[model samples]
Target: MMLKAMTVAGFSLFALVATISLDASAQQDDNLIPNDLAIEAYQGGWRSGGSDPTKECLAHFNSKYPTKRIQIISTSEESRKDWKGHVEYKYQCTAAIKLK
Candidate 1:
């Protein structure tokens, strides 16, 4: 009976640890910008017409979220025909801010 109780307690501790870790990882993921929104920001920056599209996009993000650390995780370019010939730049980003 004592051995069974100890085993159950150990399992419970392990489960608790697992749950906490998963929760932490989920919280971290929540800080990341969704892919579509990141791409939208990049496109908006490009449409604004500047010397550097990437820099423009970063500036937009920084201006919008003054407190967070914004990082571009990935970027891609594709050529498209809309009003003529144009290239679209897409970005994937993560924004993290410290909690008080």
Candidate 2:
């Protein structure tokens, strides 16, 4: 009886570990975003155009991360006139997303 009980306890422990590992892996997969979309957004932000970065970023993200729908929550642009050389454009954006 003691031997049978030990075997059952061992099996239960193994099952518990397997379940926890699978859950962690699934959570990691859910957090992953398309690399191309993130890269494009970073690059577009550095470009010199006065164009809306949020639009460009979202467009790139949608095109590359076609599996998700992104909703823009807010957008803002700030410009500073410096006597130095060229006008500086700072763009900021916030968004929410639904993943499939």
lDDT of each: 0.47, 0.58
- What is candidate 2's lDDT per residue for 6-70, written digit by digit as tens? 24645742222222336777777885555332312233343455578677658766786688777
Per-model TM-score versus the true fold = 0.33, 0.42
Q: What is the lDDT of residue 18 in candidate 1?
A: 25
Error of 2 at 98 (Å): 0.7
Q: Which stretches of candidate 2 lie over 4 Å from their true place?
A: 1-47
Q: Which numbered prediction scores highest in TM-score against the true structure?
A: 2
Winner by lDDT: 2
Displacement of the residue 69 alpha carbon in candidate 2, Å: 0.9
